[model samples]
Target: MRRREVLGSLSGAGALFGLPAASAQGKAPPLPDAALAERDPERYWARVRDEQFLLPGWRAFLNTGSLGVAPR
Candidate 1:
């Protein structure tokens, strides 16, 4: 897999969709790199996991091959 695909998974899909709105509205602060894995790795990861879009019925992890390159 490509580096962005991996980082996107690590950062959360919500970051892609939600960040623009948050930036336009100036509501949320940017997360430091360490913040993603520092304080509580499990909790942070759980939140990131929740923010992604799953394949039609699969439980977790994006199936990029099925979805194609548009979203990527």
Candidate 2:
């Protein structure tokens, strides 16, 4: 199966196992403003990383195995 499909299925399984889905964590931040991206690409990407993903800020995750890290 494709990577995205695998991750999606895993996320569903997480829900079945009583983990919170992304939406349940909180409301997602608004889409980064296009003008901000145009004006400051680095800042825009930082915003994307900080707001759009659930990765923790305290650690680096660098798994390169077949499954890699789960989506969130």
Q: Return the top candidate by lDDT.
A: 2
| Error at 31, model 2, angstroms | 1.1
Model 1: per-residue Cα lDDT over 1-72, one tens digit each: 999999889789767888889767743333335676888898765554444322332455455578542210
lDDT of candidate 2 over 1-72, digit per residue (tens) = 999999999999888876556458866668799999999999997787677766666656577466553343
Compared with the true structure, the alpha-carbon lDDT of candidate 1 equals 0.57
RMSD of 1: 16.4
What is residue 12's positional error in candidate 1, in angstroms?
A: 33
Can you list the residue pairs that collide in candidate 2?
A: none
TM-score of each: 0.29, 0.43
Candidate 2 has an lDDT of 0.75
Most accurate candidate by TM-score: 2
**Model 2: lDDT of residue 63:** 71
RMSD to the hidden true structure, all candidates: 16.4, 11.1
